[model samples]
Target: MAVGFAVLLTVGCGQGPQAQFSVRDTTEELLSPAQKAVKKALDDGFGTPHELVAWQRLPVNYGGVHGAVGEVLADGKGITAKWEGDAAGVTAGAPLLWISGARAAESTSVDSVGSFDAKTKTLTWSGAAEPAPAAGDKLVIGFGQTLKTGRMVYMKNCMHCHGVAGDGAGPTAKYLNPLPRDYRSGVFKFTSTLTPEKPTRDDLTRVVKYGIPGTYMPSFLWLGGKETESVVEYVRWLSMRGEFEKRLDDDLSGDFSQKAIEESAEKALAEFKAAKADEKPEKPRSAGDLKKEAVAKFTNETDGYEKTEFPGVIDDTANFLAQGWTHGEDPESLILPSVPRVPDDAASRERGRRMYLSDKGKCYTCHGIQGRGDGAATEDFWKKPGSDEVYERRGLHDAWGHPLMPRNLTLGQYRGGRRPLDVFRRIYAGIKGTPMPGFGRTALKDEEIWDVVNFVMSLQYQSAPAPAKPAEHVAESK
Candidate 1:
């Protein structure tokens, strides 16, 4: 059957070139001018969907660059530096980095300075310096604010399902079983990293390159490293934009309603007419003029409100988003099972089976007795997150509001990964944005988890033979 299915797919399917691109607006039209200003500021500081923002990391003490820094040379024109160890990897037109306190008068481009010399192992920058670097102050080379190479790559590959805004609301998004990720929340489901931490670049890259199994996301393994990096950058950019929008909405939703704008415009118009009535020759005001005046008033109000309340909100939001991404890179966030995996033997499998059916583990409640993914939960109604109302249909639902089904382990297909550690992490961390709960140190013992892992791994094969019924024993008197 499997062979026949593979042949059918091979004969029936053929890949095609991607469709043409079209630009889409990402902003909500209802936003007031003040709200728009805040969003624009965020876009200008960060890059927009169409443009890439150029930025350099401060020194290690001043927030290190994306990559490492090497030795520096103070020349007559400006400063020149060599790439750390692997000098050949450095590309022309890359962004240059300087210590926080010491930087160039203007942002310097790699080509503007001079071509990198491989033999001499150095790049020469003859530009003028603002505050020159002190001796031993570290300098680094980088790719500054330039167009992101990944934007086009992502548009061509991901926009259909993931959407232009990375909100998982693309034209095809509604058709998929598990809806595509909404990067706006800055949260990802599968990660070796722990909770509250966003996936690292490598984590995002791996998923994009390899693709998730048993899902609509296809592998992009054909893409080269540069292309892959570009997609990662674009995805991160979208995530930042989404997060900024969310923060702005939270801050402005109270005072900037549409009704308030209309009411304010009417009041301004009435005041204008009343003042004009006193004039010897009354001048009439148009609706457009009234709207303009109202908008100006609204802007002033927003500015004042922001000055008093926005600073802390912006700071808190920025820290929350930045920390979420950075935490994934921390080593402490990884989940390492305390005990090694239990052996895939009969005894271990039986122990795991016993636990799976037990009331405490309750795996059977959702996964079913035969591991066929036909548990009663599939027939039951569930509530949507952040809302009290129940879903229209009966079944499990992910954070995205799509109907979700438990994995049928009998198929031997693991979407996260096939490795033991990969499965273990899924059990340990619980797939984020889904109903799966992590049963690590708190809920279950280390040994028991390993047993469950072993049993789950064994599910691909037939269930272990049931133990023989023992004969009833009878005591005899002599």
Candidate 2:
């Protein structure tokens, strides 16, 4: 047995991570004590696509809103917070919905000391403790030469729900069933695999690329190619400031400074008269300082290695298919009428077809009269009674002013994932934004979902993997 100390300097660790324990993979036998500790952590949650986290642990800091209180579970599964302390007022200003980011996104709440607004969206902010001057507070609004393209992307598509200032508090917030992300508090929910905190850049990029399904969020992949990357950049910048401001606020107010200052003030009439003129004056933001900070952020991020070329369609499909193995939704050993095995003969396929068309399952309504998404109800689709109309609330427009339609699943682009289990999860969980309901206990049995699952999988929903050329023929042909 061979073992050596594994040392790793992590972002959270004071020094570079140095695993004191040794590890023992098939290649490694005896390990130093140091490697053992590192191995233990990995044994906890390490192997997933979420690289930074190996185990579930409580967050050191979780509040996203300045002075907002939050709690994390010991199990490391969830965290919740109250936007406002006033219970009754919370109801009055109830946000439609809240996008849950991970611990990293929450960190954004700490740094935001200022805000920016465009048109009707008025983003506001509370500066971080020991904060520096901010550009959004001065130059863009006052100097008035900020790029319309960069600002417009965010203001038009994101600001209404995320809050103009990125503090997660826009006026339309109440109307949204799920309040938009207060990127200021950098927490994010969707991640590729098991990650510890706010998703890494790729995680965020993917989310923006593939919006949450069955929810108010729709796929923005088309809008996310290179030209739209600027929008993502703006969002990332907003989230950074929000998290920083939030963290600073918590640190400063941790000692009861707000209360102490209020109690220490003199209330005497004569004193008040004398102090009126001496009241603290408003501190104006300095343009030079903010410009320097923004420049610094841009430079550092740009310094990283750049990806050279587009992998094209075949590579893209392969990458996702490989990822699908682990990312597919949880599967169960379901027992129902749905076919589970790959049919070997026409007889089995016939039975499967019968099950799909059978009155017991009648899976053809919304799916379409003939498996196409263009069912008779397509033109007549209406928002269910209890559901809110997300598109209506947006009330914004693109350069051309046409409305977007809901996804026609029969199209086969399956953004959630193309894996069998992923499709199964969709079949069982239903979608969010529409009238789809979970089949877990309702109409379909596990076996029946499998039956439809097989039927759906049989549909020509995805393109075939590109073929590889034969090595022997390639040289001769050339």
Candidate 3:
């Protein structure tokens, strides 16, 4: 009977750990109260990884013209807005949404709006706006400052691995082999775009829809176009948030700490309580009054500290964050080879093979001599960034501390793309967030890189070598 009960209990528990325990969510718990308040304000006004909030509407001004709603329309995957005044400064791929109230708090209700469609001047939404926006409601448009439809999609699909803050330190992050990407640096690897620039929206969308081949990031091919777009927007949003936090930390870390804020709050609460106790019986303070007084004190203390130390940090950080993303979308930042790709003939392949083996190229250091991805470097353990410790296992590792393997070119599987330009970009710009280094313009000229690109492309179609036979024994002729 005892054995049967134990068996039943084990069966009921299942093969894996039961999902009945509670884990504390430490996402924002480490933040100071003042920082938490700022994050809360951003959450309330511009949504978070967990919820969708309305965009904080701004009054429009175009050239001499000011405060115009402009004609806005929605489409399947994008939105378009046209106005009489100068819309020249309005950036492409910016976030835009309409809200009814004059202020963020008052603009509690909002439509499920998607991102702007710069090409067609249309605004797209997953569904039709409810109780359609009224005339008085203002249309807000900008980058890095709005709540978007993508926030919801990202929270559902990516928050577990990427974190609510997009720091790639989500609850499941510690368990993964390769750490998820931390977008705070606003840098992405495996882009077809140029160096020092963020990936294009299309590039990001492609990565989300089609997961990296050798990595744990699963493809979300099932998500329709609109849903994928939303996730992209949310990712950009989180990246901006992380950048802002980094900037703030740089400017304020010396002056502030969470302990200080907690102490301030505690002191304020105690003072409020004492003041309330001193009040006459007929003029007692309400619970609301004490709470309000405490909050005001906390805010004032923090505000004073900020003003005295970093007066321009807020505006500077916002502008810097916005510009960082905007510059990536600029046309001039793209890298196009000065010369066309060399023909994929045997000569070009041989030239590429030579470069791959040369010390200047150093391709064999990580990728084996035969392009088998079995290089000697894989035997050594790698160190994690910002830490004194090295990883436990031996292998190549990306910037995120995940074990990485040099691509086995013989497999002909390309994670980025198979196009000529795609291969060219990989050789030129190098894969970001990984050990790959860009060799274009600086180390190798455009033509040399193209030769390498041609060789890499040919690896897929080439036939694999047959296995070598072992030496036969004489077998004593029995």
Each prediction's TM-score versus the true structure:
0.74, 0.30, 0.62
Superposed model 3: Cα runs more than 4 Å off:
1-148, 169-179, 254-304, 381-393, 461-478
TM-score of candidate 2 to 2 decimals: 0.30
Against the hidden true structure, what lDDT does model 1 obtain?
A: 0.62
Q: Top model by lDDT, which number?
A: 1
Poorly placed runs, candidate 2 (over 4 Å): 1-352, 355-362, 381-410, 461-478
Best by TM-score: 1
Give the range where candidate 2 is weakest over 10 consecutive residues by summed lDDT: 138-147
Better of 1 and 3 by TM-score: 1
RMSDs, each prediction? 12.3, 27.9, 16.8
**Where in model 1 is the C-alpha error above 4 Å?**
1-31, 54-75, 78-80, 89-101, 105-111, 126-147, 254-303, 463-478
* Clash count for each candidate, listed in order shown: 4, 70, 10
Clashing pairs in 1: 54-145, 95-142, 95-143, 150-230
Please give the range of 10 consecutive residues that has the lowest summed lDDT in model 3: 1-10
**Residue 48's C-alpha lDDT in candidate 2?**
15
